[model samples]
Target: MTVIKNAELTAGNSFTQNQALGLLTELVPVSLNNINGREIQTTSAKKLHAYLGVGRDFSNWIKGRIEEYGFIYEQDYINFDSPNLANQSTESVQIKQWKTKRGGDRRSKDYCISLGMAKELAMVERNEQGRAVRRYFIQCEERLQHIAPQDVRKLRDQLKARITAANDFKPMCAALELARAEQGKLTQAHHYTSESNMIARLVLGGLTAKRWATGNGISGDPRNSMSADQLKHLSYLEQSNITLIELGWDYHQRKTELTRLSQRHLAKQLEVAND
Candidate 1:
């Protein structure tokens, strides 16, 4: 009889990306709130709670899997389900990763393995070319910038709704990078990269990989782990080698930096393996 090693795994298994997504989704109904100065108020927070419900349903399912099988570190604010790879004589594996940073001049997937495993994926992609995302925010922010607190709250709600709609839209970006180098000298080579690729690469540089996710769980603003839109971008940023935290996002509506890496994860792959 065939056997599955993890068949016995249950809710108590540990925390994982899938479990975490589920937990967060379940919390959406109770999570919405607003950023007030530095404090989170009940009224403003309600909108986000709603987003956690229907919008990020996909992400929520992923989180649920993590929360179920992975171990949750509330204090560390991180959860890990995969076995630690700190010590092991590893063999080659066709691991897929995102291009966290541009590899100086190398081609062929630029960089991979920057973002974590697939469960971290989110359906919300960047804004398409023709649509205007900031257009709505730009006008709204200006209109409410100097209004009274109560009045600002009203406008914020309107902006929030627009942001939600924008999240569902597929935004286009200018990709400008060699899709991949030619087999030989480019005496004759079709351009593989597009404007969308270039922009995708740049934006990937700002994402938050799994290793950096919990530690950087949307800083500054406790009002959000990361906004729904930002989370969506980062989710799509998965294969791009960026994480949500890496992108210039407003955790507390403030830009935050991710932890530095001592070396590229792909370095090992490029290294001369002792055959």
Candidate 2:
């Protein structure tokens, strides 16, 4: 593209596997019962620590954190009869030694540090925990001296290769992109002498405001960095095909008409979309 002025706000941090899984579950609650948000499989709970970008034993680290929250007490498989024994057996515990639950989806695998971190991960629906085997991406550099780096390096290489491969955005913007694609008929990409271009010489068309209250992400999408009303106004500008001229709209307008199109509107008409 022609460098559309940063086009988007700064991209946030990369997700770890657990974070991705959590986000995926949060984003697609129905999918949690399935796999990859589709009719894959329910038996296999996804491993998310790798998608979250953390060191090896991160699950243990997270579980450790969850344990630290004070509510989650690791009741040793102790013999209540022999209370002196610090460790207990699985057979004796019903609630697994009486632990106060801290932060965790029903399943420990899906749990992450924040409930509002990302869409699929933070969604409330996927917050269920079922006992299952989970996987994590272990970093090679974090390996202890005595451990082998064979699998760690392999995972690192695979993840590096997947960084670009996995960028395939989900269906979130698919509908909008389809709508925009349909608009392409009206918006001829290039027209040397077309009247659409002819009109461009005179009219400034439309605009929302000078400063954008919420400058990033979808309106009403909690994952978005900006507020719904702000995105809604920008959507209006995008719809009107005019420069929205946001608060810090690139520190330049390139032309006076582009500048003059700026106008403020009440932050109303906000609507929540499918999470």
Candidate 3:
């Protein structure tokens, strides 16, 4: 067993090109797992098991695969079973517990396995779903290899621009709220939150900024923790919302328009990412 230094996992900076392409997202969502002080692309073994239609219980299936393949612990995978391990590390590590089919709450151990290990496991399963999953992983790897360093830097620059724009929007929004209050048009004190939550819901698929922050173990603004693609989507919606606000559109109308715009923007971004 390899002793993992800094055995803590945090969110990665950006989504991979494969994710942007929506190739492996539905089948098995990949994330960056911190291991040995480096971030490696990994997927949840439990999710993979479900996708591959594995008949065995999750615990037995995962353990059996690890033992059969001689996978090194803390190298190919890491278990989020020990709460003490999280306390020892400075980084935020969220240990998720789920309810069973019978509605019993259970905190089961989850394994984040490296992409290489996942592919190997998929290949060994020798079933149709397994073969399809393995092929998808291969395609993901191929797309990832094509993402140049300059492409990454471009995305980073876009994220920075969007963040700055969002910060600038806050003061402007406050001023608008202040004017509304002066004219007796403001009905609530949380106008800033309302506007921000509107954009967040549209971009984040109904998850408000506050809920996203709480779920991710993030404090303060959740925008700081968002991925580049997410920021881009958010910034666009903010700008659109500002325009609708100035036009005297009602909340429901703005929301409807923003929802449509978000869908178009996401599709366009996906096309760009694929290119």
**CA lDDT of each prediction against the hidden true structure:** 0.29, 0.28, 0.69
Evaluate model 1: give its lDDT: 0.29
lDDT of model 3 at position 47: 76
Task: Give the per-residue lDDT digits (tens) of candidate 3, residues 64-150.
Answer: 999999997766888876221222223434456333444444455779898889999989987755666777777666566576555
**At residue 72, what lDDT does model 1 achieve?**
26
The parts of candidate 1 lying over 4 Å away from their true place are: 1-39, 43-205, 209-212, 218-275
lDDT of 1 at 273: 44
Writing each residue's lDDT as its tens digit, candidate 2 over 1-275 gives: 01111112123535333554344444222211211111111211113333333244544644454455432111111011211121223333334432223322232233312111222221222222110012111111233212645544543444343332223222212323344456562423342122222222322222111112133222322112222333333343333332222222221332332324324333223223422
What are the TM-scores, per candidate, against the unseen true structure?
A: 0.18, 0.20, 0.42
Residues forming the 10-long window of minimal summed lDDT in candidate 2: 130-139
Q: Report RMSD (Å) for each prediction in the order shown.
A: 23.7, 22.0, 17.1
Which ranges of candidate 2 are over 4 A from the true structure?
Answer: 1-223, 242-261, 264-275
What would the per-residue lDDT of candidate 1 be over residues 146-244, giving only the tens digit for each residue? Answer: 555665565455446435433432331111121112223242222222222322232335332332343554343221333333333433432232232
